[model samples]
Target: MSPSTSVLDMLSITPPGWGGVLITGAFATLFISFGAYLFGMTLGLFGALGKLSGIRPLQYALNLYTTIVRAVPELILIVSLYYAGTDGLNRILALADFGPIEVNGLVAAIAVLGFVQGAYMTEVLRGAILAIPVGQVEAAKAFGMRPGLRFRRIVLPALIPNALPGFANLWMSVIKDSALIAVVGYQELALAARVAASNTKQYMVFFLAAAALYLVITIVSNMLFSALEGYFRRGQRPVA
Candidate 1:
């Protein structure tokens, strides 16, 4: 058969094609990235707040958390956290006389990646919060604004403008990091491509397709983040 027909046959979604496998894997990747990104944001927000909360103990604890997570290699963190979390949960259950329960891979993957993402996000958000002018917060306080009110009315708005670029970077990082899930035997885009290549003995074709899919995701994400950044940066004078 010609190379064109061979490529088509290998990629075809019908009987022999692995296209469906790749598409499903891509969806899984997106789901994991989205879930982890949101979870990380929640953790980072609290982590950032804790770091700035003036409670020495809380600040120390958060510092330890972020420092360790950022220091470790991400692959090791993912594998270690994935097993430790599941095993620890089962151990807790076992103490209560319950059978070991299987954790959902999706949930486990999200939790692990989110945990790692939170550390970097903590610094990003903390820096952003720090960048806000103290005078604005002080003025709000002088106007009888409660701490909560000041945060909502003044701090958050200012924080986003500074935080957004970092957030965008994190989002892209998470998307790529989701591929690491495959190392723990979870079948995402990379793994799916591996399977297809192994079956067809056409490594280049399948791997290239996977790369193309990833590129597409990155392109779309960049567009979305650009739009969001534009929205947040509106009314500000352009930087020289």
Candidate 2:
């Protein structure tokens, strides 16, 4: 088919515009990536705490996790995790005398991405935590504040501003990294675009459209983070 004809056919409203397919895929991509980010954030917060602990064993274990995860390429990590996760779950199910548990593409993508991103986010949050003034921590302790209360009230609030930028960047990376999940047959935006291109033989057009969608998501997320950073900074300003 001619380029114009192919484009028109793929985008025709009678079939419900390719726009809807693209949008649906984009939303799926965002949903899976964000779910991974939330999982990563939880892991990161605890990992950061572990790293910051005075206990040598806890710190050492966290250090190992960070080193091993960050040392490997994300694609390799994803593939390995996908196989291992599925196998492990199957093994557990069999042991429990349950039927085999199916690992969905989205679940695999989220698990692998979350695990990988959590490793890096640990360092990011730890650095932010360390950047906070020691004096403030000491003051909290001096005031007879318990460790938990001090962390929640004094340390966390101060660490957030510094950490927000890094977290936002990590979230963007998660979105981009999710593209690699296509290898595992995840029906994410990149996978959908690849299929569309192959079927329609308009590879460049479909791929370019996918790129534009990703760019839009990243740009919008960055703008929101920028506004948040500005708000936080304003509150940090010295009173006249």
By lDDT, the best candidate is: 1
For candidate 2, the clash count comes to 0
In Å, residue 3's CA in model 2 sits off its true spot by 4.0
lDDT value, candidate 1, whole model = 0.94
Best by TM-score: 1
Candidate 1: 10-residue stretch with minimal lDDT? 231-240
Worst 10 residues of 2 by lDDT: 11-20
Q: Residue 204 error for model 1, in Å?
A: 0.4
Clashes per candidate, residues 3 or more apart or on different chains: 0, 0
Per-model CA lDDT versus the true structure: 0.94, 0.89
For 154-188, candidate 2 gives per-residue lDDT tens digits of: 99989988898898899899999999998888888
* Superposed model 1: Cα runs more than 4 Å off: none
Off by over 4 Å in 2: 1-9, 12-17, 237-240
lDDT of 1 by residue, 88-202 (tens): 9999999999999999999999999999999999999999999999999999999999989988999999999899989999999999999999999899898999999999999
Give per-model TM-scores: 0.97, 0.93
Which pairs clash (backbone N, Cα, C closer than 3 Å) in model 1?
A: none
